[model samples]
Target chain A: MPLRHLAPMLAALLALAVQAAPGNGDSGTQPEDRSHLPQLGDPYLPPAARKPAQRPPLAGAALQAQARAKLQQRFAAADTLKTGSISLAQAKAAGLGYVVQHFAEIDRQGSGRVSFEQVVSHQQGAR
Target chain B: MPVSLKRTHSYLLAITLALAACGGGGGGGSTPTQPTQPGNPADRGFSDPLAYSSSGNASLSVANEGAALTHHSLNLGGRVIDYTATAGHLIASHPQTSQPKAAFFYVAYTAKNQDVRTRPVTFFYNGGPGSASVWLHLGSYGPKRLQVGYPATSQPQPFPLVDNQESLLDTSDLVFVDAIGAGLSQAIAPHTNQTFWGVDADAEAFRDFVTRYLAVNQRTASPKFILGESYGGVRSSVLADLLEAAGTRMNGVILLSPILNYYSNCAVYSPGEANCTGFLPTYANTGAHFRLTNPAQTDYAAYAQQMRSYAASTYGPAVASWLGSRLPPSNSLVDQLVGLTGARANLWQANLSLHPNTYQFQLITGTVLGRYDARVTAPQGSALASEGDPSSTFITSSFASTIRSYLTSQLKYTAQTSYAISSNAIQSWNWQHDGQDLPDTLPDLAAALQQNPNLKIMVLHGYNDLATPFHQTELDLARLGNVPGLRIHNYEGGHMMYLDDASRVRTKADLVTFYASALN
Candidate 1:
């Protein structure tokens, strides 16, 4: 199943586990006892609440390629203050600090800039 | 990890050697020799001894409370060193067997020139697994206060200190603790930064501190109290539970602009059934205070009576309806309430929920120059969505100015570097705990009252504090029911209700009475 569909089922399962556990007042330490407290009244409502009129899932590879393109665009903007190579400070100033930090960890090649193939390589390595 | 530990030790050694060399006579005249025996292990007080000495000119004489305070650093189980310091003031003399703990504290008593009184000591702290007790130490109730209204760059450069006639020392002794890493406090061995940097870990550390304090101070008979602000309120609950388990008790617990329920308060800012229900009443009350609403009432009690009716009847339904359908008519009372909150009608018209940022900008821009001081309104400007809190700017500025001057000039504790007032270390704190998932402190509060029967709890809140809305607090207490001796008071101010003149005076009076009763 797609990750999007899997997310809710996982959330529901977690909630169920919490409900099954005993009450200890300390929510972080104990599994939540959902039985005695209060029930959601409707369990099916969540998925229905989130569903739009109509939507289609993008292929996983296509989604990855799209994400790579967006990241490259951001890197280009962040390289504005580059002195031959972009720096973290410049990336921070350009509002791409979060992305720059992530890319830095993934770049691995020691190159100043990242290429599409490098992006694909990093994506594969992550899995 | 071990390499980093070695590097840190080497750095400390180098700094110690540098200080020693500088003391051997450098640029200045004859060097003052380091005390060979370390100046009475009990008197190695205050992390920054120089800040207290050179800044204030008052003569130091031990008051009736007794011996001078002793300061020491404790390893709170982390690479980050925590200071476990206290002042030893004699409350009463007793036999060796009757002596409680040998306690020490850091205190900013009345300026040496002022008349001394047997003031009630109000113990205060902030919450954050990583937060120090600086918020109460400098911003709200300390003898040395921060000055408000000044640009960040336009300092004299360091502001002059003033005598805080407002200091609670006249009514109570104050003790501020730096939890784990945020302040001068450090963690003990075996417990790393991660160990002391979470919910349970922080509570256990405070529990240890309290246990140690009671054992050291002999204050077992003294009326004990706690004052926690923001997340500290949540922390106070956990501390209460731990203390109860240890058989210790408190006279009262005061929560200042507390964040008790993270899901209800912090996660949601806009007006929605899920997020905004708890906070709307406070927003309405603040609007009523600023004369933004149609009701031009100054008395909050009368206004609250009127608001409760509206909240249960009209306002509640209108919100439910608006959430379900297209934008309701502009003339609706809900719209008026939203408008009075200083939020743009269009935004409410668009999103139905008004985030804290919107309400803050909408309400104060015309009268105050900054977003923090809702009391002061600035000139109107083009309405734009704010990225973060405008009030934080004011809170940070006011605290920075007040604590710096108060610590150095009044109490006479000097340090090499400025005190760390607040940090982002606790911004993303999680409160969900395992096991009995208690409200953290309520059970302890119940136990304290059950144990003493005379213990009273005074819960005060500013009507305008959207940070911790009054209604949610009311609901939280409702779940706990009446504790027989507890009294709840609602003030006519925001998160820092004591900043308001009337509320501050009233709070002081109430505290004095409460302390007298607790002791008697």
Candidate 2:
């Protein structure tokens, strides 16, 4: 996200925090309250509450599995030609947004192309 | 709440659109083979939703979504005013194609025994490219208001639903319009809610709706006005021009705490020049209100005005000079800034800009100021992040519940579909307008003014609004050159100035005068 948009996004998230609060008992259940719109039917409700931030991080095999799977998915999407690797330009063109930000770090060998394993190693090393 | 939150959604949408586009291939000139389907069945070939096909059935028409009309009387200071409230949807078709698009919802209160041609009608909408019109409908000028005490969280419901003595009904007829996907509004099948989620497309949708409204109600000749708050200001600007170009002349346009140019905003995501010049006055205004800064400056409004002058003459030039040179600004400049904004001298010394978040956080120790209304504050539980604006959180549920109750018992309009206070369509809003990367609707507003020489414009802003600072609006309007018919009003409230009792009454009074003058 652009720095200009960060404040507004934080503001929005904060507003969402309020909207997600439990209702004030009136879920429009009254027989005469036929005009009330139900909260359950609201399409804009947040998909799900975020996982607790303090939860223990995945480690060992579980971490590796998750990291490998994520890298594979991203690499496959970016490497549209099925070349098993992608150039920085390819990654950018593919809209690998945040990944593109770390393209140089991932392609540490400076060969101009990064493999899925390279990305996974980069993630694991960073972690 | 709606405006701020939905903006984040629209930014996400912009990225989504970019990613979606990246997956698509470039041009294909050759047409070698025909598809299985010869043509699109859903294509109406530029026909209005209300227009019948050769084999016509009224029941199947998209525009056949009927209205629920309820008669009501509101006593404003012992003067009983009888009115008819019509709640329903108007199908807004594509401007060029005329294909049925979205069914835009609206609730209009027309005073009894008024001449359709002479009586002024104002269309009101709240900002939140994603928000419903309920804020203005129930929380502001609708005959019924959700009672909220200034600077205090509304008590648990049943929240008081009282007659708004400050309602403009006595002066002009009111029509509250919900943007597509908000409230009961939704896109007709074949077209999704995102169809009308961009700057131009959204304005076009509202233009179509307003025109259709006039035609349907046989009030095309009536004196018309538009009142849009927050992002609605951008809509009103574009919509005004669109309506005028289509020959629907508007008598007036009212913008409340509007952000006219996105590129000049202080919170732009892109790295650029730190342009906090416009926000200085608001920061000072808020600080003064809270008695954190300029405590000796008893008159907050006058102090804010003085700060505007200081910003123009001293602070703005000093920042420009600092940006031009590597040398830090003079100590005197830093002291003046620190004194006015109550921000740390180090913050001003580091960068001549004070972001609203930083100011909101630092204005009062252990108390985070509300972004919408600085007067409202909450305990700073964590230094890392804000829970939400106390102003927004306090009244949202109260207003939402009250509107739903009013709709059900008073307006007699009900539906199985929830009246979405806001939509997620902002998650995919197309921000491109006039072939530009970002929208700047001042040109559109100026064009409208040029087109209709008699068109009157009123801008209302609050002193403590951090989202769209009142000074920013002043700067934007100054760029419009000399506009004789344009009027600006500032009050002691925030973005929704009507949330404050005194500001609400003052705003209504000003609006009443505006309507009378515009009609004349």
Candidate 3:
């Protein structure tokens, strides 16, 4: 068992915690049904009714704005030295759980870090 | 499945061979030991005694002296008659001495009707207690063969045929045998069906087949070889031991994507874990292939070195902890250790455990590149949730069509029924509860190599195969303790190394050189 292999299962565990959050109800359950859902198998999930997430639906512009704001917030929180650009260690500190959880989804290079361009692309994709 | 004429003839041949081998009592062991002579008191000629009344669209041509086909029937304990197909030019006289209750085999020699003294004999069989020797016969080695696409595909029709340019018959004489119930081989009378079904029984039967073939052919002096695939790898290992016990030694043993260990390789109980371990190297390799990890790091040797270090130290602990609880501050030390292995960001984000499926899906989705190799992606699913394997899609599809076509069109052998090209025959296989129990054939193989120093073993693996990871094979071979002059090679392919163009060429070359070396 290598660290590279543990990454996904760890992400899944973190994703499980996010699912347990009350307002994020459908975020966890709905994605499970999505074709892009993780394939760890059905045994991990209990056979109970799943409540959906309760996030507000934002339109194209609003979504883009929200994504940018979130990205900025993450960068600021991760940049302990107050440096404009967030370093790899800075990103890990901001939200190691969140970053590791969504790294593959965001880091298109699969290098496991968010570059400025990658962050911008992610924000645009959300729109 | 309609009974095809060709299949019916092949079945007849199998039944005849089975009956001839298992028929007689104590005295039948006295059959002469000559290379070309027929030893069975009942072996009349090249044609089947149980003739078919119907005529076919294709005509059967009897080639003159050097090219005619010889036929025989062997009884393997079952009353059912089994037949065998052999080239006439290959048969030689039987030896003077014979063992009692030995299994009979048909030998097909190459070298243009040359004496058995001149050419080496290679014994070949496919795995499947129920499978016939068709794949090796038509796909790779047998002289006359059926061709399919280079990578192989299911038959377009029920039957498709092609000419095989890679056949090994040009190099060594081949003897294609059907297990007791497969092909044209069968059991005769008195001996129960149970005699040739189980593990030990099967080994005994094959041992008998080789000894009988050697005695009848009178070529005990020539180099002998055994080539098997999949489960046949297990069979060959056991047979290597059995052959030694029966006083015959093998010069070389060739295993094509062999399954030598079941515990580490085939036990799919822990899907996520099993696949993760198996596919890790493949991912590193794939990443290296696409320059995803680092373009400068091209070869797998360097990749494997990094991965091995990660797996043994930080990677192992990170996965263990993640599966249970958060690691202490020292655990972060493990993460830092992982960072040193390259791909620091990736290792940290994975929190250290990368499931096989996640790696597979991530590689494709993140990189926009698909990994056709299963060995790299096979173990990515949840251990308890996913069905068998995602990789089986390509493997089964590719082998099915080509096998169907080759059997029907080229060999002109058909069955009134459908043959199982591959199956879960070992689904019920249980590991020995005792720690000392042997889970695979490595023990027998090691013993054989130890007893006969001249015996050589060659293992070929597809780097992309997750089914039986090349690493697991490497690990097991190392554990065998007896470090003979063994050669192991990796092809950039899957479990079936021959499916890849590059692998097939390298494999053929390696095998030819191996055989040549063994004989000298």
Instruction: Give the winner by TM-score.
Output: 2
- lDDT tens digits, residue span A27-48, model 2: 1121111112211111111122
- Rank all candidate structures by their lDDT, best first, as comma-separated numbers: 2, 3, 1
Model 1: CA > 4 A from native: A1-127, B1-121, B147-160, B266-273, B317-344, B363-373, B377-391, B395-398, B401-418, B427-430, B434-453
Where does model 2 sit among the CAPRI classes?
incorrect
Q: lDDT of candidate 2 vs native?
A: 0.65
* Candidate 1: tens digits of C-alpha lDDT, residues B1-520: 3323433443343233222222222221122332222243323333332111111111112111121222222122232111112322211111112222111123422211111122233467765434556656655655444543322323432334443445555455467765544443433223333444455556656666665444433334445677887667767766654454344546667766665544444223222323355556666667776677664657777777666666667666665565554343355654666654544454454334444434554444332222222443323331111112233333454565665554544334445545554333332333334222222334334433333355556677777665566776765555445566566678766666665556666876776676776555
- Docking quality band of candidate 3, CAPRI definitions: incorrect
Candidate 2's C-alpha runs over 4 A off are A1-127, B1-63, B95-97, B268-273, B323-327, B382-386
Question: How do the residues B1-520 of candidate 2 rate in per-residue lDDT, one tens digit apiece?
Answer: 2222323443343223222211111111121221212132211111112322111111212433345555567789999876667676566766445666666778888776666678888999876667788888887888888777766653555468888899888987899998876787776646566767788888988988887677666677789999998778889988887786565879999998887766555643211234678889888877677666844566867888799899989988876665555245578888888788777675565556556655665556566666678888766553212333556656667777777667766666666555677765544557676545556666677666654668899999998887778888888777666788899999998877898998999998898888888987
Computed on C-alphas against the true complex, the DockQ of each candidate is 0.01, 0.01, 0.01
**Model 3, B1-520: lDDT tens per residue?**
1212223554444434323322222122232322332343333334333211111111112111111233332222342222223421111111222212212223353333334454677888776444555566655655433333323333343333333344455556677765544443433223323335445666667776676566644557667888886667777887886575344767888876666755444223322232234445655665555455643456666666676666566455555665454332255554453333223344334334443333334443322111234432232233211233333332333345665553443233343333344222232222231122323566567656643567888888776654455665776676654455588877776655664555666777888888777876
TM-score of model 3 (CA atoms): 0.56
lDDT of each: 0.45, 0.65, 0.47
Q: Per-residue lDDT for A50-98 in model 3, tens only?
A: 2121332233344335434543554566667665545455555543333
Off by over 4 Å in 3: A1-127, B1-109, B128-133, B144-162, B180-197, B272-279, B295-297, B300-372, B375-418, B422-424, B428-438
DockQ of model 2 vs. true complex:
0.01
